[model samples]
Target: MSNEHTTITESLAKVATRANELCNTVDAQIDNIKNTLKAEQDALQAKKTQFDAQAASSISQYQGKMDDFIESGDNRYQKALSKGDVIVPVNLKHLDDSKFYPVTLYHCKMLDVRVERYVHDDVSGGGILDYFVQLQNWSNGGDFTFAKQFHHSYSGRAFVGKISAASTPYTSSIWLRGGWSYKFYLNGHYSKGPVVIESETQVVERIASTDYFLAPITEVQPHVAANNFILGV
Candidate 1:
């Protein structure tokens, strides 16, 4: 009886050991499947990030190119007065009035004029100099009005502005787009009056981003010295 009982106990131990071995093998397989899925997910995420970065770069590059194209087109289409050439529009009635409730030129295009000046003179036998940037709106089978609505500009002018109001003599020359700000004066003397309405670096009003472009002007002193700065037209 003792021998039989011992034999039965040994058989049961073997069965339990075999079951444990099978369970461990199954667990290992499950771990392998989990690791494989995780690696695949990580690879997909990396590819997505790379693709998104490339797409963003492409968009930025194209946007810059488009802007350049617009600027170049505007330069050619707008009829501006060349150096040493005195020009005026022939059709006076079609011209828009300068100053007070300024209107946008036809076709949603604005006449951009920039102006800056520095001059000095004594209160005796005096001399004064003025500078200006003049532009004309060429007929596109319609509007023939010139853009003269700026500082020290007249009825036939479309775009103009005063550049500086500093008390110093300055040489007259083309003041390009740099170190300048547009000040819309609301009131009195000495550069800008007592009240300055608004100051801006650029006046960018357009039909979307690809239409009109603006530019600046000018002049002399009372024992005069001044630099009135503006960008307009």
Candidate 2:
């Protein structure tokens, strides 16, 4: 009986040891699985954070572009409402006597004139005496009405004259709503018969009353010590 009891006790001890070893193996496997899962979770979370930051930056850039486009459109609209359409100058010398000068004016309230007179160096006897430029509007076929006139005198080598409606009443500001065609006629003569002369006329469209104020101030000082600054006509 004692031998049977010892054998049974030994067998029970072996069973307990086997059970402990199985439990330890299972615990180690569970720990390894947990670590793997945790590492995968951390990697996924990092990728998610990077994607979120990139998305936010892209959204911000797109919003800024949209705002700039809107502002640019608004600025263009305001400028169109405030400013007048520019009228390009036409050279009268190029046009023939049969053809009348044609110009389109949109919201034109004032007219700006620039006349340049250049005399040849070889010109000795004759010089520019009385020079006048007239603006005539003939929207009604043959009948024409004078709009503005600029009278200037040139004597020396080269002369440049600028005349505005504000300074001279003869070249006063005129309002034209609808598009109208205007003609420029230059009536001038020289002292000693026909002399080589070059002349140009420019008409600028003004939208506001203070448009003339924006012109650049040109200082014209006479060479003579006693004479003051000569104001060009």
Candidate topping TM-score:
2
Clashing pairs in 2: none
Tell me the tens digit of each residue's lDDT in model 1 across 1-233.
99999999899888889889989989999999999999999999999999999999999999988987787775643334222232321111222222211111222123343332222222222222233333333333244423333334222122223322210121111122222222221111112111221212333233345432223222221211123323352
Report the lDDT tens digits of candidate 2 across residue range 1-233.
99999999999999999999999999999999999999999999999999999999999999988998787887754343233342222333433322222222222132223232234322443233222333332222133333343444455421222222222211222221111122222222111111111211333323346222112122322321111222443
What TM-score would you give candidate 2 relative to the actual structure? 0.31
lDDT of each: 0.35, 0.37
lDDT of 2: 0.37
Who wins the lDDT comparison? Answer: 2
